[model samples]
Target: MEKTKPMVAVVDDDPRLLESLEELLESAGYAACCFGSARGLLNHGLSHLDLLITDIGMPGMNGFELRDQVKKVRPELPVFLITGRHEIADQGRAQGISGFFRKPFDAPALLIAISEACKNRDGG
Candidate 1:
């Protein structure tokens, strides 16, 4: 039987960022789902995702709120938070995340972390 690629969900308000992350995830061999808002992601559901990467500053339901919500429903799912603002990261709201990346984050590093998180999730 063939193994399926891990599905990664990303929520970011910026369309460019969403497109970029989706392409990056796909090029790295994982399935990527992009959502423009946390509500959009929630509406679509979360059970199918292997991992989640969300931006900290969105219009409604920011990354921290979304992370809290995900923990409530799918606590085991690995979540990575990304943000362009340094102040948010400095405020220390990024606790309990699998990883945190600042915008302009190194793609290779992100991919490596994602790979490891997915592998660990599957007990591989």
Candidate 2:
């Protein structure tokens, strides 16, 4: 039987960016779930989110803090953080995050990161 495709949850305060990422993830063959707020995401989020794509500098809950919280609950889940701000993105790099996307990220790069995260979760 074929393996089920990975599912990704993308949370971003910016509606336009969130939509763009949803399209990007879907086009790459992974399922994409989107949320506009961190609180909403943490509450009714997908339990089996194979990957999480978030912005690092959200107004309420920043990605680093959000990622840390999620890791405490689900460390195995992959978290890819996006940031248009160089400082924030660079800081997240050292946080053992799954991937990093500067604003205007390339589709292939994001997809590759998702693939790697899935592989890691699968013990590859």
Candidate 3:
């Protein structure tokens, strides 16, 4: 039997960042779903997602807010926050999220973190 690729929903307001992350995720062997806003992801639904990666500095709904809303429905879901603004990293960790990565983060390290997050969820 073939294994299914993990579905990762990535939300970022920056169009370029969104596209770049999607490509990176796909290259890393995960199914990537890109969203321009938290609302866009919410509207599309999260039934198929194994993980969520969001940006903290979005214009409307920020990553932290999105994580809260997502947790309300899917408590076990793993949410990772990525931001160009490094200060928000502490806040993201305070919320007890799966992980946080700064902009220009090492893609390989991010992939490792993602794998760990998924593994922990499965084990639990």
* Candidate whose TM-score is highest: 1
Off by over 4 Å in 2: 94-98
Over 1-124, each residue of candidate 3 has an lDDT whose tens digit, in order, gives: 9969999999998899888888999998999999999999999998899999999889899888999999999998999889887777767667774489999788899999999988887794
lDDT of 1 by residue, 69-122 (tens): 999999999999899987666555455434878888899999999999999999
lDDT of 2 by residue, 1-124 (tens): 9988788898898899888888887888888889987887899855878888888878899888899889888887888889899776676577754488889788888788788889988998
By TM-score, the candidates rank as: 1, 3, 2
Least well predicted 10-residue stretch by lDDT in candidate 1: 89-98
Best to worst by lDDT, what's the order?
A: 1, 3, 2
Among all windows of 10 consecutive residues in model 2, the one with the lowest summed lDDT is 89-98
Give Cα-based local distance difference scores for all models. Answer: 0.91, 0.83, 0.89
**Model 2: clashing residue pairs?**
none
What TM-score goes with each of the models? 0.93, 0.88, 0.91
Candidate 2 lDDT = 0.83
